[model samples]
Target: MASTSKVALITGGAAGIGYAVAAMLATKGWLVNIVDIDQEKGVVAASIGATFYKADVRDYHSLRNAFDDTMKRHSRLDFVFANAGITDPRNFYEAQTSTLPPEPSLALLDINLKGAVTCTYLAQYYFRLCKQGSQLADFDPTLVIMSSIAGLEVYSPIPLYTAAKHGLVAFARAIATPFKESDGIRVSCICPGPVFTEKRKPSDADRLDMVPMETVCNVVSELISPGGGFGRCLRVLSTGISDV
Candidate 1:
């Protein structure tokens, strides 16, 4: 008999929040497909019972190739985690005075906003194709996007990062209803506050109030359940999580 375990595709699954979510999903009997730019970390991910694909999220062709290969291997995709992103420490306001051609650093927008958009577009396409001619009326595919507390509130240290996150929040909300109506694919965003990852600075004020990585993983696990979340943004804090 052929195994029919569900498949989950996660971008930036090599480390941090993305890796935590991928590991948790794998434990729940899911076949995890991890897409990452770092080949070394990708190899590590593959060793942990995940299928690793090397790709740059900033390039749609690279991301699409990974998506196609996963579909070919698993025959179905039940979930997509568009979790690839990078932060910019520069203050855009201060950079406006610079004379360089690319002063403010567009890397944040490219990897965070554009990458997420590419993932969402591909997720919808793949999910729709997977659901073609399905008779199960209860089928619900999902696309979980990664946002941050910056998406909901103002964060001054990283202005570009904040704007990118805010864009993600808007994107998720705008497409959630349409995606649900079109293909029963629920779209949700996770807005976590101050997770203790490599991205966190040791001298930061929020260092003492960091939320555990497990909490974010738990929230993601719950979101994957049948009919659990749709068109919702869950704000996870050190204290508790709430729908925002």
Candidate 2:
């Protein structure tokens, strides 16, 4: 490992895009911490040299404990990936049925929008707190959030997922400037189109339109690099990437 290798924390890192990001960082020699609700994959994460903490992003206490454990293990935290999220197969309209009439799932909002928000808030807090004992550098630490192309444009079928992703994009943009000026913490977002992660069921057409998982990880690597800019929204497509 490099002498100056950094530490990174990724939420929902047990599988899919989160797991890919964790592996990318690990290969680069970063001390990666994987936080997710799945205990089984958490063990797999540990096997790959990442410290795994079973955490549900929706719960503040659960998240805090994970953060605390990460801090205890590592002296400093240089990057955070607020990537935990989920979507219901049923949209709001489809959820209404004459028979059992399932209540609209707040699970989407809770885990997607609110959970990302909570992770961002706590990340900033810990970044500042941990830096208090030492002099801060002009630039280094970064927060790369996982938004989606659904955030930039609307997708009607999954209204709830679209809404939550839109919230993440707005949240990243709104705080970018302030975090840069006040804390020297770079904030950026990645908006990928129809990524073929395990949680998503993509059709043939969707796969054609989808960006590669590696492409999304590269965007995050760019954001975490020292020369990276603040307030950038990177959108990935099957063709390539664009800064929006």
Candidate 2 clashing pairs, residues 3+ apart or interchain: none
Whole-model lDDT per candidate = 0.87, 0.85
On the 0 to 100 scale, the lDDT of residue 232 in model 2 is 96
* Residue pairs clashing, model 1: none
* Deviating ranges (above 4 Å) for candidate 2: 1-4, 95-102, 135-139, 198-206
**Clash totals for all models, in order?**
0, 0
Residue lDDT tens for model 1, 109-206: 99999999999999999998889875545456889999999999998878889999999999999999999997889999999988987666766635
Alpha-carbon shift of residue 103 in model 2 (angstroms): 3.5
Candidate with top lDDT is 1
Cα-based RMSD of candidate 1: 2.5
